[model samples]
Target: MSPALRRHAPLVLVALLVLYPLLPFLDWAVTAIFGVRLQLDRQIINVMIFAILALALNLQVGYAGLLQLGIAAFFAIGAYTTGILTVDKYPFQLGFAGALLCAPVVAGLFGLLLGAPTIRLRGDYLAIVTLGFGEMTRVVILNLENITDGPRGLNPIPEPVLPDWLRDGLDRFLPADRIDLAAIHWIVLAALVGLLILMKNLERSRAGRALVALREDELVSGCMGIDPARTKLTAFAGGAAIAGLAGALYATNLRTTAEPNTYDFSYSIMVLCCLIIGGLGSLRGVVLGALVLLSFDNLVSPLLTRALQEQLGHDSTSVFANFANWRWLIFGGALILMMRFRPGGLWPARKREVDPATKADA
Candidate 1:
């Protein structure tokens, strides 16, 4: 690398690390330039949660080449686990920290339970089985009104409590209104950074290679003595654990948990879209995909809604102003165009080659 490139590499990485959480600060410039008031902080936090979810999905679809279509099930599992554990409800009152520790474990156990039976299946069958598992989970949550509160879900879940030292310092720096939001943002951002580092390390490990091999050719991998069943089950369980962690964070941040309806197929599809658009088997690609899709879903669509109302010269409630529903149509079309033009994704992973000299002569 050139001297300039080398010097700037660390800075670039640092900027990217900060970009997701700091996106809301950009609204200041937008407000100054375009006279638009935007809630960048809330949107960015939401995106961070989605980004973590995408990372988990990437582990399944990207690394293992598993077409898991029911990730939202794991997400819901985590959310409800956190809610039930942390909320001071009729029968439980575990702390947020305890919920954080236990939720992923429960979720991973569920993943193992689900994967054990289905990992032997391949392709579409595996996908269908997993999807059915996810839907079945939702139905159970929906019907368990006595415990889960059913469609009403759980409420008054406690906000994640911060250490006194940190809380005191934050209170000194920020006004009351900004303190809670800023704390949550920083905490979530920290969790995301931690997950990124962990996943990146996993991608470089021997186990990761086994996953890649399984993705490339399960039969050949099995012939080489790798247990495809064990590897796939591990990936499924690990990915589900990550999803569960994300769900816990989300519930604690929102201080509430919705019914199964809130975590339906649409959310699962969105997470899958993030992995597909980002690039299979690449962490950087997954993050990029999440940001792009989330930016469209949360930021661009809202702006377009306002723009359409202005162009129609009518109130937003008018039939001509029904631009919100069109957002998904446009998004779906864009996905098709992206797949058609760049099937490998915008930032596809570069294939690494094994040195010929290192290979045994056949």
Candidate 2:
């Protein structure tokens, strides 16, 4: 392939992949070709949503070398922010767009506040602190009964206000069935594309270079005139903002209570795993990571459990029947295997390289 084709190939492939779900008879094709009812509609939407969270995480651990364990706190903050603003019991009733607009900003503000104090810490210290923040956020939400309805969480979060035409377009090919997420799915796909473009550009921007430099050596980066402190702060806040957006979307889609327990430390770790397994610092890696890991947990686990039960003699008390219950054990094993055999990831991000031709042009 030409250099240009090599460069653009990933983008082209992603575009096609994103569009495949919308095609007529795509579901039929999957069932016919693989004899597997691959219900991709919701699954693809889920992956795209989590992909945003994974991409957010890439900014910290992947690019800036910061160990963050509080990503879910920001996610919770975003979800709760929407809940407080949009739920009918609340006075604001900001609606979906308002919540969407404010979710990331609120999360970013929290990130800013979080980083201002802890940005100086590194490695495990930082991780512990962020982990504490995550737990604390959940605990606080659990206790805030008046504001958040405590453990029950806020409910009835509004959906996005899409145009009738867009909804109509989404229904053109599919049966007028369930929630009809076609429009929402398309919007989220657009957001993912926009985020990917933004992140790729950021990877090549001056700020991105400074972040990479800091990752390599904070002292050296500071000596070279890059403000390490500010860069770290930016990384934290920016990453949190992206995660918050994902959370807001999640809450809106569920249209149910945003339970405090749901945004616990485990959720943060799962998202972290998604980024790591996909290969840190790689946007495409995040997409793959979210799809692979989440699909395993959401889609494949059930099938595997049922198959095992049928083969091993169906018994709810039998270990085979509890296969789906081994979610974390499976994830933990996957993490270990990935770390051992493919530490860089299944689709690891390429190491940065300077092209003499491009440098000379610049």
Predicted model with the maximum lDDT = 2
Candidate 2, residue 144: Cα displacement in angstroms equals 1.1
Residue 336's lDDT in candidate 1: 90
- lDDT per residue for candidate 2 within 192-220, as digits (tens), equals 88899999999899999899899989889
lDDT per residue for candidate 1 within 1-362, as digits (tens), equals: 99999878745865664554334456677667755666767767787888898988888888898899899999999999998887667566887788888889999999999999888897789899888888888999999988788998887777765678867876765556566676677778888889988987887899988999999999999999999999999999999999999998888777888767988877888888887788877777888888898788666777787788788774767754766677667667767976788867878987888678776563
Best by TM-score: 1
The 0-to-1 C-alpha lDDT of every candidate, in the order given, reads 0.82, 0.83
Give the Å shift of residue 5 in candidate 1. 5.3
